[model samples]
Target: MSQSDELAAQDAGDSGDGPIEELAELQVKEEARLEKLFAEQREERGLDDETTLHTFFKLFDMWIQLYRLNKCMEVLPEVVPICRSRGGDFHVKGVQALAFTLWKKSQFNDAVKLFHEIEDLIGCSAALCENMGHTYSSMGNFDKASEYFKRALQCLDKEEELGKKTGDRAGILLGLGLIEDRLGRFEQALASVRESQALFRQRANGKPSSLVAKAGMSIAKILLKLALQEPDDDKRQEMEDEAIIREEENVALFEVTCGEDSPLTASALRGLGEAQKRRGRVPEAIASFARSYQIEAQKDAFDLLGIMEVHNHLFGAHMDLVKLGNPLNRASFRNYLPTVDLALDRVRSMKQDANAGAYYKVAGEFAAFAEEYQRASKLLSEAVCLFKTEDDSKVEGLISHCEELKDFCDAQLSAVRGSATANVSESKS
Candidate 1:
């Protein structure tokens, strides 16, 4: 063979008759391996690449998990891009998840922005509108929340024709119930939740869904709020009884569906704890609250609130014991005061309208009696302002007490001045 031909043959042999085919094959293999790793990670975290209910739920779960883990930035980029690429059901779900994550992180403005984006994209869905309402409500924007809740109910009404096909009537009803509760429409809330419960019963042959437990909890919470709003002892007792029944139902449902360790189970247990506290069953309430708090720490806001409430109840129980001249209870009262104060601080920070006024009132009274006069005055002012805005008849006694305290302080000041002047006159004589 000629030298040039031999050289060409050698080149061909070196290249395998092409330009680095093996290198290209190796690059493809590497890409596949990386892709596999990505898929595995996604699956491990309960996320999917497609746009289906399962995928949406997986994404929701992942979003919640990431949010709880404080890994928002890590998951936000990956999910947002996928949502933008696949604009449909997945987009709506992504937006909802993003909004919830933002809300959880206390990014209210960003959460509102994502909520609006979802509303624009999907026109109106009951779930989206309800969630937006909840976000607004949490931010203390009740007017806007009410507006969104109305829109959600409208959406549900419009889609009523497709109820059989969608199989989400109960969900829509529950969403409406939540909105009603937020808006302080307790009767309406109860009606909606009861309707949802009935629908679930019909569909599941009297078996409650996990969703029903949530609805029951909502109803129970609303009932408790209503009881708080009532002045008449009999009426309050009736409402409390109703709340207890609803809470019991929620606990039973959670026990049946979620086992002991599930978050819902913890929540239901907490609801029972709250009911017990209101009924003055201190020991039972403490046990339930402790169990719920143990299931989840400060991760769940509700759980945190429950723990705080339990501490407050314990403080009250100890105070009662002290009043009965129990030395042990007096020691416990002193030891728990700081813990109670911490819990109250957390509850104040949450700024839930339902509890804010009460917390402020309690803090004001505690401060005044504890000789923290300046703090007492500020907290009392806050309580008065919130109670005025609340428009509940039940706060009349509290308002009256605050006014009496203000007047008494002024009188005491004048008396002190008079006494000081008399002492000066005596010294001069």
Candidate 2:
């Protein structure tokens, strides 16, 4: 068989024999070699500890391929000390990898600190500055992020003048555009994002790309903000229509670039859904969010937080559908309530205690909106309990809101029960 056919056959097999298995076997052998290296006398074997340590550290990629990121990071501290002891480019490269790993793990502050250390060691490059920008942006320090993005752009400009390939130019502009948009610089944001989109499309050479799609989304979002600020109704409508079209195109691009069921596609769908929702396309929005939820739910590492956000969006869309006062929409709305409940319960089961109370509170409000008073009461009670135990003062406003919702639910339940009792008495008479 050809190599491709053999690989396909191995993938289709259920015998637990494949490239992954081969990688696993390799990892075991390499681990054994590392153990032997550690146990042997380096002087007698004429082996260098620095080289051995660096080689062992590079096994991080192997561990990552095996989906053992946490384990890889756990062992990083030990390897870091040896690299630092040796110093120079070797240590800088190792630290850079560790910093990126920390960023992937959502440890943004630590990643920023390491990126700074790299800068002190070898100065800043376009890649390092872009990474710093992303780290700061993730931490919600948009001003700092903008600074780094601008610095990265400057470095890329210098590289361009020297006839060097400035590959990350588009990404830096996109990041800067997003920061500017957040800071309410709509015109500047649009200019930067349009430039980024052009560069990305040039790089893609007419092929679909996630970066191109993302830049399109940024432009669409800016248009949305401008639409909100527009005083003329016709101009506002024109802007809104253009935004929706671009959003739809972005969704299509993401579907082609990253498979329909991929998380990236799912996220793009959510963005499209929000635009549709704003345009009063409630049903379309609901469909978009439902698809996103399905993709997130099916992932191996369940995105509980993503699922939670999807639930929030779905609940809001369904409620909007009910507001239309159509008999069919209203009838179908109750059916969605149980699905939301089940999904939120699944998230609650994940023990996201840090945000569990907030989740329950939001769920309770949605339940109350749907007139499911009893369910709302139960959820709000849970919220109160969870929040009370964990910094009640911090969530005083939330607690107050929950209490108000619970009281409203109680009154509605009482009225419902009383009306039922009166009806039964009348029947008996």
Model 1 — which ten-residue stretch has the worst lDDT? 1-10
Q: Write the per-residue lDDT of candidate 1 for residues 1-429, one digit (tens) a residue.
A: 000000111111111223222122233444355445555766776444552333334433433422232444456667776777778866765666666666665566788898889778867666566666656666767687778767766776777767622124465566556657766788898898788767766755665445556667877787898889889999898888877787788777656554455555666777777787787765676567656655543343333444545445545654554565755433333333354465556666776563576666665555555544565666667777777776658778787787666556456556778999999999999
lDDT of 2 by residue, 132-192 (tens): 8877877889889888888887888887889974338777777777778778899998999
Counting clashing residue pairs in each candidate, in order, gives 0, 0
Candidate 2: where is the Cα deviation over 4 Å? 1-94, 294-310, 327-354, 364-378, 390-429
Residue 202 in candidate 2, Cα distance off native in Å: 0.6
Backbone clashes in model 2, listed as residue pairs: none
Runs in model 1 with CA error above 4 Å?
Answer: 1-74, 86-90, 103-108, 162-185, 226-238, 255-266, 296-307, 321-429
- Cα displacement (angstroms), candidate 1, residue 264, comes to 4.3
Among all windows of 10 consecutive residues in model 2, the one with the lowest summed lDDT is 1-10
- lDDT against the true structure, each candidate: 0.59, 0.69
TM-score of each: 0.56, 0.68
